[model samples]
Target: MIGKLSMGAGAVGAISYCYYDKKATDGNGEKAVRGELLYSNEVFITKLPNTHLHLQYLAAQYHQVAQLNTKTEKFIWHQTFNFPPGENVSNETMVKIACDFAREFGFEHNQYLVFRHRDKPHEHFHIIANRINANGQNTATDRKNYERIQLFCREMENKYGLQVTKSKQKSYAQSSSVQADKLRKLIDKHLPTCQTLSELSIALKKQDVIMYLGRGISFTDRNSGVTFKGSALSRHYSRSQIESRLGKSLVLQAPNSKQIAISDQSGSKNLNTVIKSKFPSQKESLPVSKMISEHNNATETRKDLAKINESLRSVKNRKVKRRIN
Candidate 1:
C-alpha cells in the first residue's frame, strides 16, 4: 500500500469534490452509476441536501473558535491510500485504516470524510480531513508527518499482509530519475565481479549497454538514444568508483571491441596508449584526479548516510519484534 498526504488551503473545495463526486460522469449504461458514497460519520449529516453545508458549518465553528478567519491556513489535509491491483479490500477495512492513520497523525479529534472510489483500476480511498483539531488548534502537518505516514503504512502492510511499498513521496518523486539510478544499480551489480576492463565491457554489452572511457567515462543506453555521465548517474557510479572496483588501468580499446587487455604494471600507461591509439577523436575533457577526489568525498558521505539508515531500520525492526513477542 502507498499513502500520500497533501495539504490544501480550501476545505470547501476539497470536501465538496469528494462528498458529491463533483467530477460527475455522463449518465449512460455502465458509466451511469459509478459508485455511491461509501460511508460517513454519525456526527455529521450524510444527506445530499445537508452534507456540504454541515461540513462548511464545522469549518465555521473552527474559525469562530480560533477568532481568526484565514483562508490561507491550509485548512484541508487530503490523503489517499492505494492498494495493489487484484487486491479486494472492503469499505469497513479501508475506513478502519484511514481512521487509524488520522489518529496516528493527531487527527483523531478532527472531523473527516472517507470516500472509496471504484473508478480507478486499483482499489483506493480518499480521506478529506480538517486541519483544525477539536481544541480549535491547527493539526501538526509537516515533513515529520510524512515520515509518520510511511511508518504507519509499513505497520499496516505487516498487519494486513498487503504488498510492501515505499512511501508515495519517495516512490513518485524519484520516478523521473529512476533510469539513471537503475544504471547505477546495474553497474554496482556487474562491476564488482569483473576483474578486467574487457570482461566488464563484455558483461555490460550483454545487457545491451556500452560504457565508454575516452577523456571521461559514460554509459550509453542502446535502446534509448541517451548518454549519462558516470558521476551524473550517481557518485557511486563515478568513473573513479568504477575504476577503483574494476581497476584504474582499465580502458575500452574501442566501443565495438570484443575483448580488451588489462595490466597491473603498465595500467595508466596502457590506458593512455589505448586512448591515443584507438579513440584519438576523444580527448581528456576533465581532470580525472580532480573528479575522483570529488566523488571520493561523495562516496564517504553516502557511506555515512547508509550507516545511519541501517541503524534506524535495526531499531525499528527490534521494536516491531518486541511487540510481536
Candidate 2:
C-alpha cells in the first residue's frame, strides 16, 4: 500500500474536492463525488440533508473556534491510502482500516470523514480531518508527522495483510524509470557518506544495486536490468561533481594485492606510493604486451558479477510469487 498526507489552509476547497464527483457534469453524467459516504464521525450535531453544505458548515465552525489572526492556518489534514490493483475490499472494511489508521496516527482527537473512490482500478480512500483538535488547538503537521503516517501504514499493512509498497531505496535499486526523481533523492542520501569506490559499491550492493567502477560511473538495478548514470540522475551526482568529493579514492583495489594496481600489478612495490602519486597514468598503464590480457580479465569479472546478480534476482522473484499466491 502507498499513502500520502497533505495539509492545507482552506476546508471548503478541500472538502468539496474530496466529495465532488468530477464526472457528473451536465455535458457528461459523471459523479460529483465518485465514492459513497462510507463513514463520518463528529462532523455535525444533526443529520444534515446536504453533504456538501454539512462539511462546509463544520469547517466554518472549526474556523470560528480557531479564531486566529491570520486566515491562512493549514487546518485541513488530508490523507489518501491506495491499495494494489485487484484487491477486492469492501467499503465498510475500507472505512474501518482508515479509521484504525487515523487512530494509530494520532487523529483520534480530530473530526474526520472517510470516502472510498471506485472510479479508479486501485482501491483507495480519502480521509478529510480538521487539524484543529477538539480543544481548538492546531495540531502540528511536519516532516516528522509524515514519517509517523508511514509507520502507521506499515502497521496497518501487516495487521490487515495488505500489499506492501516498495521503499524508495528498493524501488530505485530496481531502476524503475518511473521513479527517477525518487532515485535521485536516495543517491543524494547515501553518496555523501561513502568515502571510497569499494565502500560505495558495498553500500549500494546492500541496497540490491550494483555500482560499476569503470571510467564512467553508473548504477545498475540488479532486479530490473535498468541502469542510470550519475550525470543523468542529478548535477550533484554527476561524475565530475562526485569525483571532486570522493574521486581521489575511486580506484578499486585488487584483492590480495598489497600494491595499488588497475588492470596490471605484477611488479608494484608499494600500493601506498601509487595512491599517493595521485593516479599517475604512466605508472598505472599496462605494458603494451600485457594490455590485452588485463582488459579481458576485467571484462570477465564484470560478466561473472552480472550472471550472479541475475541468478539471485530470479530466486527472489520466485519467492515473492510463491508468497503472494
Candidate 3:
C-alpha cells in the first residue's frame, strides 16, 4: 500500500496530461464536453460526454455547491493497486470497485475508469475531475481525498475477502545507496580469491545477494546495495557457467564462531595484500559492480535533485518576471 501524490503539472505531468488529452479526442468528440474524462488509452474513451456539466448540475440539484472566483484547472488523479495473487477480480471489476468506493465517499458526481495494461502484470486505474463545485469554487483534493480513498480500498478488501498489502513504511529507491555500501564491503572481501566469475557469485550468494539478470546481471543486497553485471566479474564467463559454480549446486556452510574468525582474517589479509601489491600507476583493479552501482545511483540522485530544485527556482523567477513585465 504505497501512495504518492503529484501535482497535475510537473515532472510527472506528462502521463496525466496524456490521459486527459486522449479522452478529449476519443471517437465521440461531440460528447467529450459533457462529463470529465476519467481514463483513456489514446485510442479508446471510457466516460460519457457532458459528465462534468452533469456533475455540476447534480451539485446544484443537491445544493452542495462551493463558491470559487476562477475556473479550476482540470486535474487527474491516479491510483495503482497491487492486488494480491489468487484474486479473481478482472480489470472491469476493479474499476467498478473504485467507482463504488468514490460514491460511498460522497463523490457521487465523479467519473472513474479501470484500465488494463497488457504490458504489465498489475491492474491499475485512474480518476479525473474538475475540482469545481456547482458554485464554481475549487474543491480541496488533499489529505482528506487520500484518507477517503484508503478507507474505501480497505473496505473493498474486507467485503470481497481480497488480500490487501500492508502499508509500505519505506521506499526502496531512496535507501538503495545504503544497501550499495554494504555490498561494496562484501565484494571487496571476496574479490581476491574469486579467480572465476562463478566463485565471485558463490561468495556473493553466501552473503544473501539476489542476482537479477536482464540486459546485464544485477546482484542486489536486500539490505543495502546492488552490483551491476560486468562490474565485478568478466562478461567472458557465460551465465550458465557462473550459475553452475554459484547456484543450487553448491552447499553453503553457515559461518560458525571459528569460521567467522578464520574468514575475517583471510578476507582482511587478502584485501591488504591485494591493495599493497598494486603499483600507484599500474594498478590492475577489476571492476566491482557493487561499488559502480552505488556511485552511479548517488550521482543520479544528486543530478535529479538539482534539476528539481532548479525547476522550482525557475517557476518562482517566472512569477517575479511577470510582475516586472
Candidate 4:
C-alpha cells in the first residue's frame, strides 16, 4: 500500500471531485466515466440521488465546518490509500483503514469522506477531510507529511499482512527537462501506430500524456501538470511535423481487394510502383484492384502514343503543301 498526501484550501471542490470526477475511458475514445462513492462519515443529512443536489449539500456541510477556522488558509486534508493491483480488500476493511488514518492524522472529528475509485488499475480510495475540528483547532500541517504517511503505510501493511511496498527516497526526483525527454521518446514510439492526430491523442491518453494540436503543437504530462511546446522539447516534434507524421495519405489495397486502408509505411513509393513490386508475377495473378489500376495506366499511355503519331502526320502534310505551292 502507498500513502500519498496533499493539502488544499477549498474543501467543497476537493470533496466534490472525490464524488464525481471522470478519468477512466474506453480505449476507443468513447465517453469517460468515474467510480462510485463507497463510505461516508459523520452524516449530517441523508444522501440525495441527484448528483448536483448532493454535491451542493456536501459543499454546504464542509463550508459550515470550515467557517470555524478563519485564520488557516489551507484547511483541506486530502490523501489517497493506493493498494497494489490484485489485492483483494473488502469495503469494511477499506473504511477501517481510512478511520485508522483519520485517528492518526487527528481528523477523526472533522467532516471526512472515504471513497473507492475504480478508474485506476490499482485498488485505491480518497480521503477528503476538513482539517478544522469541531472546536476550530487547526490540526492540519503538511510539513514532511509524505514521510509520516510512508511510515504509517508500512505499519498498516504489517498489521494487515498486505504486500509491502519498498519505500524509496525522494521518488519524485525527475526534473521537468527529464520528464519532457521521456515524453518525447514516448510520442516518437507511438507515432507509427497512429494514423491521425486524434488517434495519436487517444493513444497517449492511456499513458497519461495529452497531445494538443493546432498551428503549433504542445504536450502535457498529466502526472506532473507540466506542458511542453513541441519545439521546446525538440524541433522534430512540432505541430506540423507531427501532424505530417500521423497523416497517412497513401491508400493501400490488397493484391485484388478494394478495401482501402490509409498508411505511410511504404515511404515515398508511388502506388502503381508498389503494386507492381508486390505482384511481379504474371498479370493473371494480380488482384482486381491492381488490374484496374494497371488498365487505366495502359489507356493513358496509348492516348499519349496516338497524339505523337498525329503530330508526325501533320508535320509531313505541311512540308508537302509547302513544296506544291
lDDT of each: 0.66, 0.66, 0.46, 0.73
Give one digit per residue, the lDDT tens place, for model 3 in 254-314: 4332221112323542222121222323232334566789899999999999999999999
Q: Whose TM-score is higher: candidate 2's or candidate 3's?
A: 2
After superposition, candidate 4 runs with Cα above 4 Å error: 23-33, 49-53, 168-325
| Per-prediction tally of clashes | 0, 10, 14, 3
Query: What are the per-residue Cα lDDT tens digits for candidate 1 across 61-133?
Result: 4345334435337767888888888888888789889778877876677667787778778998888777666
Which is the leading candidate under lDDT? 4
Candidate 1: lDDT of 202?
Answer: 81
Estimated TM-score for each candidate? 0.46, 0.48, 0.33, 0.48
Model 2 TM-score, 2 decimals:
0.48
lDDT of 3: 0.46
Error of 4 at 77 (Å): 0.8
User: In model 1, where is the ten-residue run with the lowest total lDDT?
Assistant: 167-176
lDDT of 4 by residue, 26-68 (tens): 5656333354566667646455553232666776777777788
